[model samples]
Target: MAMNDGMSGPGSNSLKGITFLLVDRNEALLRSFQETLASYGAAVYSVCDISKVKDVFKEVKVDVFLADMEATGQETSALIRSFRDSNPGGSFFLLIDRVTYKDALSLIGPEADDYFFKPLDPDRFAQTIETALGQSRPKSNSLAVIEPYVEQLKPYLIFRSPEMKQVLMNLPRIAASNQTVLISGETGTGKEIVARAIHVLSRRAEGNFVAVNCGAIPDSLMEGELFGHEKGAFTGAHKTHRGKFELADNGTLLLDEIGDMPLSLQVKLLRVLEEGVIYRLGGERPTAVNVRILAATRIDLIK
Candidate 1:
């Protein structure tokens, strides 16, 4: 049994219980659309800043991702493809101008569930969303799906070596808390699987588990990628964006290659750990977020 908690409003067209993540730089438009859907009881998470559409998933899981295709600078087809890669079971819809609707139709064919043009018709907008939610009907099994895998792996999980047995035995107990866990090992030693197993046994089992490789992302974009930034903060800034810390709120964030993180970013990360809040780049106010940090490193941190 997965935890699928949501309730619909009083009518047939209610998008009740369907979680929405809306992306658009136009604050008024985003708010209007959110109000329209939220009025029907959909749990909404929104970030109207950020260049790439796929970046929003850094710390959040959503049933439907609605975006402004062109202004966001993330092409319609590519956004659909990238988001679908991460969330194969997730639903996606793009908002395009009528002038480019034909191009959107041709490019995002079968990739996105649907699209709507600007100056949206309120009734049709709601209907299109309802239709998209309706298409993703099976609902996600999520971390609950990992249960069968746990049992299958259990039989072969035993360690004849004393050193390995003790480590395995303590794993379950460690997973039971909200503590920050450090997992270290040589390359390809099943460290990620161990982390997943821990997540499966933990209370956050129902929430999304996000993983990011510190060594993979570029240094210039790392701050914006992890802490997010406000629109107009930089030259190419398009909209408000949420970082990985925000994306992982109420869930797990696996920080792989923690050692590879730059010194300056490490300072900011330490602040997040110590204060439980993060200040987005170029933004004056700090945003509070709750994310369980699971760090992994190939090398020993101390000498």
Candidate 2:
């Protein structure tokens, strides 16, 4: 039986950057899953030939393995067993056709990380895959956290002046915390470098480090650039964009040239910082984000 949601969004929300190996007997179904999921920033590779599973696993860094198995339970179990032997860290999900849903439950529910019934909800299916992958994700090596920072920030952390020394000394504590940082320095003083150093030391080191020049963007499009815009928010907005804040979710966002930011946007910026949410241009609902903000300014705004 053919099942599909047909040109809909991901089976779940936020499939961005997820890589998976999708296995199913139905060639067309696999292709559809690949196209639909890939359209939403997911890395999906369709595997119609189950016998090629070993070969596929060898080539892909698969985060999740989703198989549609209407075949014998014995074959399904054997394949899963072999898959686990090769990629134990990979998340597994079973897709059972409605007719065989009941019979497959016993094999799928316990052994697999998760299961989806036929006629899968694009959103729900996406959510299940994401959730299982997250749960089964390998724990990052704690010791390795400092390794990256040392390599990236070595050049910037070197300065003989007392003031620079103080800044470098306190950097680790600053980076370890989620507090908003205000960096003040003239142009060519490496303000952005400092911001990157802070991000490297933070838990968000693995996440995105987005920096935007507040003065570079025109006043007309500043808000839209910072907070994103809905499709048709304004002229030429063909599709919705995930602004710096959204792109930096669970990460660090550096708003450089803060002193040059227009007063009107500054007020809105403060509100977003306080509320931890932003309303996209021409959007009805406010989108929430968890972003570490780093602001840079050279001029004193006290006057």
lDDT of 2 by residue, 88-182 (tens): 66667777654554445555435666455566654445544443333233344233223323555686566556666556655654664455789
lDDT agreement with native, every candidate: 0.68, 0.70
Error of 1 at 134 (Å): 42
| Alpha-carbon RMSD, candidate 2 | 16.2
In the range 240-301, model 1's lDDT, one tens digit per residue, is 99888888886788989899999999998877765668888889998977677899999989
Report the number of the highest-TM-score candidate.
Answer: 2
Which candidate number maximizes lDDT?
2
* Cand. 1 Cα-lDDT: 0.68
In candidate 2, where is summed lDDT lowest over 10 consecutive residues? 1-10
Stretches of candidate 1 off by over 4 Å are: 1-149, 152-165
Candidate 1 local lDDT, residue 3: 17
